[model samples]
Target: MSDLILHHYPMSPFAEKIRAVLGYKQLAYQSVLMPRVMPKPELQALTGGYRRAPVLQIGADVYCDTALICDVLEHRASTPTLYPPAVKGATRIIAQWADTSLFWAAMAYNLSPKGAAALFAGTPEAVAKAFVQDRAAMAVGMTRLRPGDATAAYRSYLRRLANMLSDQPYLLGDAPSLADFSAYHPLWFSRVINPVMADILDATPGLLPWMDSIAAFGHGRPAELSPLDAIAVAAANTPAPLADEPFVDEHGIPLGSRVTVTPEIFGHEATEGELLAATRMHYTLRRQDERAGTLHVHFPRIGYVLRKAEG
Candidate 1:
């Protein structure tokens, strides 16, 4: 097995989720720091164009999306399972809610005028404007929650989480599962990154203790790896072999077709490549770049759109 390399920035919420998972699993990995915004050429080379944060790279296999990354981690280290056999289904469903609805609401509330001002306090005006524009581009078609609406929704969600935590040490049970990690990251952003806007968390007394417990799981042992070196690692190796299962084609598209896969919501950049595997749960794209060579990029099926590439 190739060394696990995570390409991420320090402040990415999704990356934080993966970091905590790494900590819980006690796994050591290589850290490839990435820019917070666009022009991520090296990272894009590995992913084709799925420019989401916290992409897990193993040799030439690139795993996009934290959900899939968590799955991969679970496979890599199965002792402390993210999905307990007793409540696996419920844990996954709650994780989905946390990643989507709860995440948006918490972020909107955190980036409100006051929060934004605090976030960019000493930063130059141009830099702040660019950040705003970049995020706007990513969220083009999605209906974002207004600041006021987000506050209300966030408050309600926090209370619900408080209720959940009141009984158990962790969300699904005594041990922290996928639900705890998923639910913690967005709130982690609010509390850690945008502390100025984190007062909303005060209302739910039970939530803070839970947050503390989750935060205690520091990021796993990470050795810094330059982006260039990470790319070199991919270019030097071949992608891992795929399973021999029959192609599960739902789009009338056959295997080996030129296709594009993109997120249906935010960060809708398309990655075009030869369709290598279209399993029920995910899609694998085989794309080559001058610097990254032949890489197999993987994306979860739920939040992405798959279409045959136009010639």
Candidate 2:
């Protein structure tokens, strides 16, 4: 198997989710740090235009979105499974909610005036402004929860999580599942990234111990890889062959058509390519770049929009 190369930065909550999963599975991987802001030139070479943090690169195959990455990882390493059979359906649903609703509310609260100041403390004013503007551009069409509303919603969500943890060590059962990993990242950001805003967690005492247990699954051993070197690896390798599954086309677009795929909400940059595979769960695009050669970019079916490319 090729090295599980994860392109991510330290502060990405979604990246933290994948890192924790790697740790739980005891898998070793290579880490490629990516820019937190825009103009990720090397990564864009591999992904075409799907610019988001924490892309998983296995040779020439690039897996975007943590949800799809989780599935890929589960396929690679199944022991201490993320999707426990009994709660697989519920686990996936909960994970989706945590990745979207809970994530936004927590981020809104964490990036409030007080929180942002603490977050960017001692950083140059220009750098801080750039970060804010970059995020604003990504959030163009979506509505963000106001800080006050976010605080209220975050508090309520925390309490609900506490209720879920009151009985069991993990959210679904005795062993950690997708639900636990999904729910932990936002709180991980609150508690780890911006400790000043983490006072909110004090209201839900039950969550603290659960968090400690999850945190204990330290990120697995990671050797650093240069971005350019990672790109070269992709250029040298061909993407693995796609499964022989029939296309499940919800859109009028056909398998060989030129198409674009973008996240439906935040980070909506579209990636244009020839549609290669549209399985029940994901969409794959075969795109080429001078630096990265041929690559198959994969995105989860949910939370993403796929459309025919305009001439």
Best by lDDT: 2
List TM-score per model, in order. 0.98, 0.99
lDDT of 1 by residue, 1-311 (tens): 23999999999999999999999998999999998889799899898888889899999999999989999999999979999999999999999999999999999999999999999999999999999999999999899999999999999999999999889999988999999999999999999998998899888878988889988988889999999999999989999999676778899999899999999899988999999999878999999899989999999989999999997
Please give the lDDT score for candidate 1.
Answer: 0.93
lDDT of 2 by residue, 1-311 (tens): 33899999999999999999999998889999999999899989999998888899999999999999999999999997999999999999999999999999999999999999999999999999999999999999999999999999999999999999999999999999999999999999999999999999998989999999999999988988999999999989999999898899899889999999999999978999999999899999999999999999999999999999999
List the pairs of residues colliding in candidate 2.
none
- For model 2, the stretches where C-alpha displacement exceeds 4 angstroms are none
- Return the TM-score for candidate 2, rounded to 2 decimals: 0.99
Instruction: Provide the lowest-lDDT 10-residue window in model 2.
Output: 1-10
